[model samples]
Target: MHRLYVEEITETDGLIRLSGQNAHYLTNVLRQREGDNVLLFDSSGQVFDATITDAGAKEVVLKLTLQYRPKEEQSVAIVLCQGLIKGTKMDYVVEKATECGVSEIIPFYSTRCQFTETRKLARWNKIAIEASRQSQRVTVPVIKAPVSFSDLLSMIKNQTDSRSYIFYEKGGTSLKSQVLPDDIKTIYTIVGSEGGFSPQEISEAEATGVTALYLGSRVLRSETASLASVLLLQFMFGDMVYS
Candidate 1:
């Protein structure tokens, strides 16, 4: 079944109106018609089975049939504290990170960051939503506005019951050496931009209690590093479990 993301869904059984972009997507883009069934999900982590009751040029109405709430599992929240990279690279990070089960993305501007002026929160959010839909995720990752490096440090320092790590190409503890804490509620992984992190920035982050991690001897692009860090952390701490 095709899955569509709605901002919120309150009624468990009723006719729901979908207009604007969503309506156009179902009617024109997907060529869905009346009586077609679609899966609808919202940020509340609820999935609904809906059948198209009315299909019009301006709007499409869906009748909620059933609600399915997945079994809750023990998972750590992953937050990517990414250094602002230039152009489409940042967009790729947001898209892939959401698919990789990242809970939140915080783009920060460090000393080595190239692009610090423009904030693409809207574009990133759109990418996140599409990625979530494609990945069959019930909830979309929150893409926060870019913040300064110092501000990012402060935010990490203030977060309780969370473990933070900064991936530095220079040198740091390997992922295998660190032990995953069972009580950790959130995991914050920091990756630098094309220029990478400066020594001073690494020191500042370390002083703020962020562990420095190295992704082996291979040099990776800014976008590659961002995805790698998220995926690795997800496997160890988040929802990427081996069955």
Candidate 2:
């Protein structure tokens, strides 16, 4: 069954309304109609099996069947503090990071970042929505607007019950050597832009308690490095639930 994320839903209420682009997708693109079955997920991490009760021009209503699955979240939550990159690279990072079970994604401006504030943030949010649906995630990760390096450092340092890591080529320690704290439910990993993080910025992050970790001898692109680091963290601290 096709899955979608909805903001408005109630258990045992027997009704769900999907409007906006999702309704359009089902109506025109997927060609789905009344009586078709699909899955709906809410931010609460609940998946409901629902049947299409009505498909109209303005909205699509689904009849709540029952809870399809229980709440299933990754053991180790990951928030990717990704540096702003050019073009669609940020889109790719959001999509893949969703698939990799990142709990949240924060795009920030670094010393070497190439994007400006005028760029469309809605497009990035849409990519995250689609990716979450495609990856069967029960909840879409929270994405924040771009922030400055110093502000990001402050936020990371203030995070409660979570560790922070920065994936850099010059990182002295391998990622595998580090372990998630027993009480920590989440971890934040920061990745630099095409030009990587400046030494001063790295020092600031380190001063804020973000550990630097190395991938390997060969350097990877921004997107590749971000995705790989998240995957490795999940593998070590959390099971490969998507598999």
Pick by lDDT: which candidate is best?
A: 1
Off by over 4 Å in 1: 71-74
Model 2, span 102-159: residue lDDT tens:
8889889887887646365788777888898998788888889888989998988887
Candidate 1 has its poorest 10 consecutive residues by lDDT at 69-78
Indicate the residue-level lDDT of 25 in model 1: 96
**Cα RMSD (angstroms) for every candidate in the order listed:** 1.5, 2.0
**TM-score of each model, in listed order:** 0.95, 0.92
- State candidate 2's TM-score: 0.92
Candidate 1: tens digits of C-alpha lDDT, residues 60-111: 9999999897535337888988888888988899999888889899988888
Worst 10 residues of 2 by lDDT: 5-14
Counted clashes in each candidate structure: 0, 0
